[model samples]
Target: MLGGIIEFLLLKQSLPIGLSLLISATVVSLIAVLIHRLFIAKTKNATELSLIIMTIGISITIRGIVGILVDKNAHPVKPFLSFSSVSLFNLVFSSQYVIVIFSTLVLAFLLYFYLKKTLSGKIMQAVSMNSLAARLFGIDVGLVQMSSFAISGFIGALAGAVIAPISFVQYDMGIMFGLKGFAACVVGGFGNNNGALIGGLIIGVAESLSAGYISSSYKDLIAFLIMILVLFVKPSGLFASKDVERI
Candidate 1:
């Protein structure tokens, strides 16, 4: 919803495609939770997996219905930005992809700082890591859990909006990417936003490189392989620490 509007705004302003997508993605992602938390509150689902399943199911169902109703062969909207590249050091990447990278980085740092510095952030980290102790401290566990899901959902939707243009976002579009990203969240360490960010980036770059140098069909598989390897080696995820503060 927000992505669509931002795309329209970019078209109106004549902003570059890459810049428009990046800006819109961040803005809309920041707002996507208005709906994500709405659903979570109405339904009583807990845990990231449950929220993920719920959101994924909704995305697929809506898209599937649209695909059937709209006629799947309809032409997609064209990119509002250019694919031309400019030098940014030594590596050459899509101007759009570069924006994605930078946007992710900014979001990651903001989240990390929020978690490490603010009172609410500490409450969330403590609650997520140890609900019993958090409750013992008189924190509302349900509220904290909702906040966590809300943040995750907002990020997911933001990813959906940003990546939608890079690929044609049909009704069924969110599944593969969402699955890969969720795997990334797990491999990076659940409850750790920094982990999710790094995991997503690693997955994204690996995916891009694999598709560029290897096979496009194998791009998505890399996330699963990474997840399996990480599970076997670390079990708790690459960034998980003893500081999870389990109750």
Candidate 2:
């Protein structure tokens, strides 16, 4: 969705970079919300299964659409920020990498604070723990779910924008990202945000080291291998409790 929009706006319409990205993000979010309301919200049982299937279907549909509308070839996005590289402790980092890291940290902090401090966040947490109890306590479960989906869409769009400049955008870019994200969640603990952050960092470092030492071609393989090891060792995830909750 975003790749197609960016390609169309930049190549055919000749829009400015910022505007194109903004429009793409907004459109994608709206479409996601619509899909959630139509397909996701209506599930009565096996909601997680429905969601997983729908998500995969949506991803494939978006990829197919983008391949049809835009060329399957990777498209380059103009650099939004440019600065000289900085070196510290014999390691060099680009300004863009710094920006991405800083942005991710800030977003994570903000999200943690929101989930810890805000009433809406509390309601969301409550719903996650027990939707029936949350509703019994007068919380709007539907609203919470919709808000989560909207936030997810926004964050996903932001991620796409951030990565597009560093790596060329392509129709199938979401596949690897989605897999890594899922692996991170699984390794971190399914319901723990901080664990997800830690897991992502671990995965990132592991992949980089694997590529640097072993083989660049096996970087992705290393990530999955880590995930499999984690699963085998701690199926509940690193941060999850051994005891299962009884609903």
Candidate 3:
């Protein structure tokens, strides 16, 4: 919405996408902070009722607004090139698959370096590793948490944008994307970015295979089954942090 509004008003692309991404990140993180401050942090109880109620309200509000905006319409995007397959070792790969795999690897390395080499990244890890110690070192824990959430939001938005170019994105599309992304996070092990990436890829590949071999309608069920199997065999995650000690 911001990007579209900017391009219409400014008649330029120079600042539209970047500025939209920034604002989206800010807004997303601000909402997250509001929920934390209003419900989670303020509550004496640990049952999460406040948080749940707030989120339920948010969900209905979003859906109601989106439902009003959408019509019974469908459109599709046409790729610029002809369909062709590339042979990679034993498996045959399509252009889209190749792009997805390459981008995933690049994103993985970029995130790894971002977390390891950057000062903010160090602070983020420190805050998650030991928040009390991090605070004692003069780091603003609240600010760090907000920044971390902002980064997560930015990534999520970018991923949505990428998918939108290929797949039709409606206002309500976030539901399925968020679910899959959350599943990936769980598969990756919460608080571990590397794990998230691995988990996402694993889920993607599993879904692809299952859809190819089994009924397409059962892909979701198969993905959940895979998740259950992984948890049973590797409780933390198949690609959980190496430093994590098993109980």
Candidate 4:
């Protein structure tokens, strides 16, 4: 939603690219926080289920609003980074892809360090493990959840900003990306950051191989097939350990 609006502002209204992105990020963040406070925090039963339903509704609403505002057309975005392609051995790659790789690696390292070493990150981990226990220990679980949501929103906005230049910005552009991300989580281990990273890499490779060998149309099918096969073979996920709780 923000991506579409940002593209519109940048291309249609001739707004400065940086300013457009900043404005979209700010507006989206505020709206997300408001939604979380008003509806998500007020849910009384099955919070996760409620959140999923609310998310679907919000996604549909955003798509509709973006379509109405920007029309159901794709908008091209100017490349944020451009460089000559480089060849190493027999392989050739664009500088944009290299930047993406480096940025991903840096972000992953920072996230790992933060989660493992920082006080707030540890607190967030504790909340994830057992919110009731964290609450009993004087940690505000609601605050932790809110902070997590904010951080997630920030990361998502950054990703959109980075990828918008490479891909056409459209009202429904996120649907496939979001589904693939969900598949990655399932393939790895849900709630496991390391697993998510590994899962995403595996999916990327799989999709590429499928498109090369099978067909472009089968790329998505292959991804979901991998996900389904993993679930059937080991529902705990490839990286997840089975846990047995004592009664």
Candidate 5:
């Protein structure tokens, strides 16, 4: 929601798409860091449930503020490409879909590289695996958490901006998107990025198939139905590692 609004505003000012995306993502990343520094980090002895409630409250606050600042009406975002679409394999696709796919793959690869090859990323992984143990090893758990939030915000903002051309910009649009993301995480295994990616692909394919073969109205329902089935069949998810603990 915020990302789409920011990108829309930037584009309205005639900023280049790439520049607007970079600035919007940077601003959102900083805001996420600030959110942790000012809110999450300040909580004393915060339980998981309390933290979750706090995040929900924060989300509502942000949404309400955005609604007031930006009109609630949906706004169309221009496509990144000058051309409308492209053809491949005897099929036509919106140019924005190509950009979205490319961006996802690039981001996923970069994220994998960072987590697997970088020192700070390793520290982050350590903290995520065992904060107390990481702290004992002289890692700054709080810093790692803040970095995690920043990365999440950056990626989320880019996602919103890239998809805006297709989905349009709306103040409250994040709700459904966030729900679908959670469903993806559930369908995949929590803490497993590979699983999450595959899970998202499955959901996306399912939604597309439903929209084609069934009523378009059943798209969302089909995604959740698949999620429910997955949960019932394997609560840990299809690719969940035996060692991976669920939260």
Candidate 6:
């Protein structure tokens, strides 16, 4: 929500879309780091549930603040390219959709390379797997945690910026995307990037099909329903690996 609004404001100022997205992503990344450092990291004896609640509180606070400051109105974002739509194989797609798909693939590959080939990324994996053990090995767990927050924020802001052109920018727009993302994660299985990517694809296709065949009003519902069904049949997700270390 905030990211989309920031990008919208930057575009309003006649900034190049690339520059606006970069600025928005950087600002949000900084904000996420501050959130972890000031609130999350400062918490004592925090359980998963407590952290989840605190994050939810923080999200609500940010949403309310943005609504108050930016007004509760939807703003249109222009497509990044000149063309509005494109046709391929007799099918039509929004140009922005192609951009979104290409961007997602490129980012995923970069993230995969970072996590698999970089020492810092290995340290992050170690920290996530066993923070206490990583600390014993002299790794800075806190720094890794902060870095994770920054990466998440940066990716989220970029997603919001790109998606705004298709979904419209509004204070409350993140909620649905957030929910759907969580559903995708559930469907994909936690801790598996490949699973996540496949899960997101599944959810996206399901929503599109539902909107076309059933009703647009129930498209979001279809994603969650698939998630629930996946949980029932395969709680670990469709592509979940039995070996935790490999994931």
Tell me the tens digit of each residue's lDDT in model 6 across 1-247.
7778999999999999999999999999999999999999999999999999999999999999999998999999999999999999999999999999998999888888888899998898888777899999999899999999999999999999999999999999999989888888888887677788889999999899999999999898998899899878788788875432322
Give the lDDT of residue 187 in candidate 5: 88
Highest lDDT model number: 6
* Candidate 6 deviant stretches above 4 angstroms: 242-247
72: Cα error in model 3, Å: 6.8
Candidate 1 positional error at 1, Å = 9.4
> Which scores better on lDDT, 3 or 4?
4
lDDT of 3 by residue, 58-163 (tens): 6666556645654323333232125646777888966555655565678678888989999988999999888889999999987887666556655555455434
Per-residue lDDT, model 3, residue 207, is 93
Counting clashing residue pairs in each candidate, in order, gives 2, 0, 1, 0, 0, 0
Best by TM-score: 5
Off by over 4 Å in 2: 1-21, 44-46, 88-90, 241-247
The candidate with the higher lDDT, 2 or 4, is 2
- After superposing candidate 1 on the true structure, give the runs of residues whose Cα lies further than 4 Å from its correct spot: 1-59, 65-83, 212-214, 242-247
TM-score of each: 0.71, 0.88, 0.69, 0.87, 0.96, 0.95
With a 3 Å backbone cut-off (N, CA, C), the pairs that clash in candidate 2 are none
**Can you list the residue pairs that collide in candidate 3?**
188-195
What is the alpha-carbon lDDT of model 1 when measured against the actual structure?
0.67
| Candidates arranged by lDDT, highest first | 6, 5, 2, 4, 1, 3
Pairs that collide, model 6: none
How close to the true structure is residue 69 of candidate 2, measured as C-alpha lDDT?
Answer: 76
Better of 1 and 3 by TM-score: 1
Per-residue lDDT of 88-155 in model 2, one digit per residue for the tens? Answer: 79999876677678868887888888889999988888898889999999988888988887777766
Sequence-dependent TM-score of model 4: 0.87
How would you order the candidates by TM-score, starting with the best?
Answer: 5, 6, 2, 4, 1, 3
